[model samples]
Target: MTMEANELRVSESVPVDTGQRRGTRPMAPDDVAAVGRLFNRIFRRHDQASDDDLGRYLQTVFFGSPHYSPELGSVVHENGANGIDSAILSVPMAFMVNGRPTMARLLCAFMADGKAGAVGAARLARTMRAARQDMCFSDNASPVSADHWVAGGGIVLPIQSLEWQRSFLPLTAAAILAGRHFPIARSRVLVGVLRPIDRALRRLRPSMRPKTEGECRSEAARVEEFLQCASAMLERFAIRPAWSPAEFDWLVRVASMNRNLGTLQCRKVVLPDGRTIGAFLYFGKQDAAATVLNLVFEEGRERDVAAAMFAQLDAEGYAVAVGMAQPFLMNAISRQRWLSFRHRGYFCMVTRHADLKEAAERNDIYIGGLASETWSRLLTDF
Candidate 1:
């Protein structure tokens, strides 16, 4: 789902596999429920949301938003009663490519059975690439999807994953880390000892407390407000996604459907003169872990907004937080001593016309939590 540079040209073509019995076809309006069932069956076990709740959520994910286009999406047919085994949903996104307004596809809902494997995945991946012209990319690729992406001519960008931090509940964070490294650390005594130490550390540093704001305090905000905040924050990079009101509305609405994985949250920082200087959209996890999906602030005043947001989270009982390390938000997050981690998967992309892969590596373009499909679909289950 991409438009030509400097012009809005939507392609009417839908890609179909020429020779395979398990050929690809565009997603039909009626297929919404089946898509929901398939996705729920695949992800519901690990996902925290209830089955009925997730089905409703999936409807909004697949078709409820304005970002969807049947022609730009693809599904694989099988011998099953529904004749469908897998799917890849596409969102037609607007971008600032080479300093011009552009459209691209951020692929979503990519799933296939183990039986489908690379063969089925490769066919579907190719079909998606053919659906767009400007570019086709995904930052939420699973290990299997990453392989399929390369098989279809996409290149994975070498950028590192975001920085993450543990604050109040450092014991739980430490326990989880230790459990991963060695099973012996999973003991009641270890937790009991560390709990006291963590509390002492908090008491020693009064500055660790989140501040209460009179005017610029955190409050509930709409998705539109979140995007308005995003648009106002100019890019540090040369290229970035330039979304329209409609697109932002759709993305934010979809993003708010966090299911039970996390509570969808928006925090706006207003100044004394009644001006909104910054805002952020985040996932407040059920386990008290806050993941900042999108953070927008005025260029020179990023740290101020960030400090206010963190303070608010601290008051709300959030013990830990994580965020993508976009350069704009680094100064704010780094001040808290957030540790960096390797990106889990690839920032896989492919484009016939421009050097999208090169641009991504050179930091000439922007791709982060919100621009990718991770906020709504991928990270929700985690």
Candidate 2:
């Protein structure tokens, strides 16, 4: 059904002939309910949130983050300040640009797929670019939004969210085959069938899984150790987020916010000589599905890191293994079986600076599903 009226913003007290208005402004404390209603109106999911749940989510997810700022987000009021027409939420973050600490906006959750979609989108792009930030990028834009951003001077990097998985039973063959025929056999159905087989196989042949050869040792990783490993490993990328221990901690906390959800756990890899070669983090646990949040290691230590990860995961009894699809990690583990993958999302950027664009296109910039976007954080549990 066509929308009866487009949410219009006002540029001036008197209306213009073009009908384009400028009712863009930063979200405020009182605008919480309207924003929630708009989100419900745009994406119908999980039964509409109550006013309390919406308020709590706003305060916790949107306002609790270290980068929270009312001014960083833009909302349009088509029916005036009392209601919302459109909005795009972003969180300012620090990234390592050539190993230097730099600021950026991780854009997510937009006013697309709504009644006033076009006007809201254009308004959001304009508002975000005009905001005081070094760069604005997103890892959550769909094809429709991607086209819009491209036409509006945004750059879509050739970054993909590659996926890799291991099957514990013959049922896993369904997932492998499911990719070939889109929406054919259901994945959950396959997994459900394999759950019992996985249990049965573990008792008979514990070594049916691919064996890792090496003296690599993995232990519960300390926060500091993981951060140190990240510092050393990420230097290979010319442009990447300069991670902070606090932010990493905060991301973990956010991941844990959803009750009954899987967790993000860190593991450090060591050699026989007790040298910390690398560290990795993953969500979900053994006999269940899981995904890699990150895998950081030194330049020449890829083998050690990969071996240790495989051994650790195997020992843990994981029914399935998944990767976050970062190019560096996926390329390193290219020899493994990756039956299925998806366009994680488009890493589209809108920047006035040339260096930023160059760095991104050159693959100097390192980004992934977990490192950016709120939906990604929620989806990483998969």
Candidate 3:
């Protein structure tokens, strides 16, 4: 059979003599539309997106990629009627494991219709685990999904699951947080009322004020510069993304497309000697909280780079800054009393390799940012 024919055959439901149909199969390109519809119904109900838009996003993220692998493709659960009821997306990635190239998969957008039940979700999860990959992981699993993952023998990274935030304008940040539930809190009049109080609070607390030390400086960072800094800084870890220049560039471009998070900002921190020590990527708008996508720095210069990044955000008038609690930056983050942390989502992994599991447990692997699915527009855009 031709490759296309064979793929269709595999993705189609198989019937036994008893007339029972198979439950799961490898996801095909044709399944994108149905999967997109299911995703919109489950996760994007508040702001439903068009099937065409979702299909384009899924194609770009899952099918149209330099790292796409047939052997480790995504999986979907099929109902008795041969309709897609659940989907577990797997984005294939290349990684360097102690200097050797290995294949990894980032699981994202695991969605199921109510008809699928827990059994269908579990079946799809099993299909994903059966794929040929060194490791399978996710940092965006919901609480319900996390429970299923742990039940299925996955381990959760506690520290990595927390999100840390530093409020430069505490009252303004509080108002914004409240706005999520009560729209009135987001009114300009209320924000205007809180501005003076936040300013006074910043004056009273030295830690709350943005660091203006001139020891390090930040400038707009290009993808090439970010790749260079990230490659060097991540070498300390035993397992890291082994993206080529082209692949790394593609990843950054895709990440920059998520405008829902806000405008993408890429900056590099340097010293007077023109030496680049760190680079940070985030999305922000004036007078709003910025969501940091990735922050990488030289081994001993975390504090310096972090301070510079915060100062840059303050200058841009962001009310607050937040990001994943990367293990390497915990000390620097703890030193700042103004920063607070809360449980965001579970970071879970399923791997049979002892070394990989050990590295993850020890927090010695690069698991977030480009290594995970947070960059996908599926999570940000409806």
Which candidate achieves the best TM-score against the true structure?
A: 3
The Cα error of candidate 1 at residue 240, in Å, is 2.9
The local distance difference test score of each candidate is 0.62, 0.61, 0.76
> Could you report the Cα RMSD, in angstroms, for every candidate shown?
5.9, 6.2, 4.0
> Which parts of model 3 have CA positions greater than 4 angstroms off?
1-22, 45-49, 80-82, 117-119, 130-133, 180-184, 187-189, 212-214
Q: What's model 1's TM-score?
A: 0.74
What is the overall TM-score of model 2 with all chains considered together? 0.80
Instruction: List where candidate 2 sits over 4 angstroms from the true fold.
Output: 1-22, 45-51, 74-78, 128-133, 168-192, 198-208, 259-261, 374-382
lDDT of 3 by residue, 1-382 (tens): 0012233234444555656556777788988878887787888764254567778878777775686756566777776665777878777778887777777778877887776545667666665442223677788788887887677666789988988988889889889767756869968899989988888887787678777445899999866777788888989998888888867777777777787667777899999999999999888866877888788889899999988888888888888888889888888777765788988789887765678778878889876777776667776556
- Where's the lowest-lDDT run of ten residues in candidate 3? 1-10
Name the better of 1 and 2 by lDDT.
1
| CA error at residue 124 for candidate 3, angstroms | 1.1
lDDT of 1 at 139: 70
Record all residue pairs in model 3 with backbone atoms less than 3 Å apart, i.e. clashing: none
